[model samples]
Target: MNLLEAFKQTKFQLSGHGNRNIKVLKDAFEQMDEQQESDMYGSGKIIEEFQDKLASYLGKESAVFFPSGTMAQQIALRIWCDRKGLKKVAYHPLSHLEIHEEDGLKKIHHIEPVLLADKNSVIELEDIVGMDEDVSCILLELPQREIGGQLPSYETLESISTYCREKGIKLHLDGARLYEITPYYKKTAAEISSLFDSVYVSFYKGIGGIAGAILAGEKDFIEESKSWKRRYGGDLISLYPYIVSADYYFDKRSQNMDEYYEGAKTLARLFNECEGISTLPLEPVSNMFHVHFNHSKEKMEQILIQLYEETGIGLTHYLNKTGEHSCYYEVSVGDRLAAIPIEELRNVFNLLNEEIKK
Candidate 1:
């Protein structure tokens, strides 16, 4: 693709729902008026107030706000490692900490991860049951991203939590998309969060903030994390942009999670019926899933090029790995793409199949 055309190449986009900037501004203005519009860092009260609200919302004794999810999570690990007097954390092979994060847990936190689940599968309790008692904490991602947002059965989650309690191991939730899982489990965020010792929620994922994360746990745990946050350079001078935007998006999208669930199921169903397109998890358990392309990457790129040149849809973030004959692919459904009618998605797939047939 030429430079100009390359810049315009977008066939489908993932997670486009939380773009209500006007609403966000309105909320910010309202909060400013109530609080006299003091600077964010001048008092550190803004972040503390936000933490209090978040802690109560997550059912934790306290919460700490950070500039980034990565830093927040690593700090959690450091704390767990210190508490248990163990250096290892049990997590899924596809866990964000394992595949992503640039090995920050190892280099920064000085901890090791015991891969708990087989690659390409949701984590199971059995995976960690046989581990030595020295395991510091168990990290659970509610919707396994690489596995098409698959989650372990609630029974299994309960079993795992029970085991953690029995073994006296810490349970930490990588709840970046925790809010999105509530509808799937038919549970409330507080209900689900109560099962874990500590929960980390992202403000930018489903919440559509500029960028921020909240780590919630017992008062002591959260207080300790603040020290780690400062040490890890996560303490920001002003988190108001992230905080204000997060608060707005939380209020706006908390009511629409069910709608997102419906959209995810619909898109997965439509993709299943399309020729040469397949999805992992068969059914979407969250607002994201993977779509496999049953054509060579060269052919798929050609189709993507054509689709973008002719239409404005943005699909597939990176190269797919479906199978030998067809390139594999995955699609994440979120805000902008979800707003489009179901018929539009079906039509796109229809055109894709027709082009492949040609």
Candidate 2:
């Protein structure tokens, strides 16, 4: 059978909280009151209270819920550019805005993005200091996701934040997996977020909610974002479903970030011990990291499909080709890793090591 089919048949998987099926949403709503009112086009208690709670948690004066981080972030850049009248921003070369969003920020807002740093490295304070052109905002992704969840040191973050404020450049955070990094830094979410002028966080990522994002900043900044949220057709008649799921999962999983972080380290060590396999960072800074295999994708797929059938332990269901002879996949540790028996997990890796060596 194919890799995905084998993964589906496995008795235990070694990534994510669980299957993101309708049951995920069903569980979130199971304890909710049947008569609870839904939010209306961004108003009502359901939306506002969650926004307030998240804003407070992130140490922002206000927050707005958006249907997606794509919409929230594009509007954030637009607002920053409008305020400075510069229409330009700086971010890492591998930013989601650059690689994944189909140039929505550029197409919709006409905001020019000045790519910084090499594609494979996290952006350092020096990269920002060395920019030749002036821009209104600087966007930083904590534990930069594209580069195997690598992170800049907290000191570097502080230096960058201080420099941006001194130069009147707004600092925006693409904190899609913000909570996942806090354990490594030993800081509160509010402490980390206070360095950025504005922050955008995703719900469906490390939080494992159905889907949603929160944009938090000064009251005026978030108020402006609400208008942009409407302009971007993000204001659905009722976002209660997304909001409720977000709230439920945030409470359920937020406290477990430290556990997940340790779980990631444990898993990374196993991958590293296997022949022809290694993980980026050597050690993970967050609950996610990339696993690289020296074998070609075609060969790795064959090996993994057989491994899954023999062991009923799924490590990953897909791979991304990096070179003719190399492939990789990302792993984010969550509740699922805890379900596998410890001895079984070790046996799976022991077999994995033997197979890769052959």
lDDT of candidate 2 over 1-358, digit per residue (tens):
7889889999999999999899999999999999999899999999999999999999999999999998999999999999999999999989999999999988889899999999999999989999999999999998898889999999999999999999999999999999999999999989999999999999998899999999999999999999988988999989989999999999999999999999999999999999889999789999999999999999999888988988999999999999999999999999899999999999999988888888
User: Candidate 1, residue 271: CA error in Å?
Assistant: 1.1
Top TM-score model: 2
- Segments in model 2 whose C-alpha atoms lie over 4 Å from true places: none
Candidate 1 local Cα displacement, residue 269, angstroms: 1.1
Which candidate has the highest lDDT of all?
2
Evaluate model 2: give its TM-score.
Answer: 0.99
Q: For all candidates, what are the clash counts? A: 19, 0
TM-score, every prediction: 0.89, 0.99
What are the lDDT scores of the predictions, listed in order? 0.77, 0.94
